[model samples]
Target: MTPQEALFKYTLRLGDNALIQGHRLSEWCSKGPILEEDLALTNIALDNIGLAQAFLKYAADIEGKGKTEDDLAYKRPERQFYNHQITELPIGDFAVTIAKQLLISAFEVPLFSALSHSTDETIAGIAAKGVKESRYHFVHSRDWCYRLGEGTELSHSKLQQAIHDLWAYTGELFEMAEEDTILLVAGIAVDLEELRPLWKETVATVLTEATIQIPEDGTMHTGSRNGVHTEHLGHILAEMQYLQRAYPDATW
Candidate 1:
């Protein structure tokens, strides 16, 4: 692919990750364990969605398309979305959600930190903003991992199971595509492989503090980078795109 195509896909990938993960977090809106936690998750959701808008708008500009961020987000089919599979997984339980967030936030902290210095001005600007938000998210998830993993026996058990179940999906986060390689050479994208060691170290440190045993790495799940995802993304789009699909061009 050309540099322009790679840049567009790279931007869209970032936007999709933020948008899908934000939608998952928003599901906890009123369902959080307490009022403060409820507000916290929703606020994070808003932050991610806002970030998604920035990335998607940049992607649209890069594509030289008239599409708005809303059009790209609401009109894309499941196979067209490039979000990591982990982000699209259902928010199963409180412990599971925390586990997912812990892994994702840890990855984002370093990934965005590097991207903040990208040669691409727009990507660097977005990453500069993203680094701050992602750091907060990482801290929040890390603290909760400590709490849930060391609390009651039941809580500890749930946290352990969640980690075990989610471990395989973590590998997919670092899976690079041809677009990523192009952008890497152009200094427009982080080398995800470089982020893996840092991500593992951060995760291992947090898990140790949480008194949770790190699961052994096994066969890894992947394919989202290639526009393939688990069944969960279909459900996400069905709900997210309902209004846009039903109303056609209706706008308030």
Candidate 2:
């Protein structure tokens, strides 16, 4: 792919990840363990949605299409989306959500940090803002990991199971594709491979503090970078795009 095409896909990938993740988090509205956490999770969902808008808007602009961010997000087919598979998984128990958040936010912190220096001014500007938000996300989830991982036996067992279930998917977070290679050469993409070590360190520190044992590495789940995803993505698209699909021309 040419640099332009690569950049568009890269931006769309970022936007897709945020949008789906935000949707999952939004499901926790009024469902958090406490009032404070209910508000906190929703607030974080808003943050991810805002990030999605910025990135998808930029992607639309890059494509030079009249399409808006809403068009890309709500009108696209499931197979056309390029979000990480992990982001679209059904949010399980509170512990599962926390585990996914911890892993994702840990990766985002370094990814956004590196992107903050991207040669593309718009991407760099967005990344500079994103890095700050991701840090907060990391800390919030990390604290929860400690709380649940070291809590009562039931809580600890659930948290450990969540970690094990999600560990395999973590490798896809650092997967590089043709678009990534193209943008990396143009100085517009962060080298995800380089971020892997840092992400592992961050995860290790949090798990260690929580007294959680890290799962032994084996086969890692892959694919998402090429528009391949779990079956959950179709379900997400069905619910998310329902209104738009039902009335294509309707506008607020």
Model 1 misplaced regions, further than 4 Å: none
lDDT of 1 by residue, 1-252 (tens): 899989988899999999999999999999999998898889889989999999999999998879899999999898889999999999999999989999999999898899999999999999999999999998989999999988999999999999999999999899889998998998888899999999999999999999999999999998998899998999999999999999976688
Residue pairs clashing in model 2 are: none
Task: Give the TM-scores of the predictions, in the order they appear.
Answer: 0.99, 0.99
User: Would you list the clashing residue pairs of candidate 1?
Assistant: none
lDDT of 2 at 170: 92
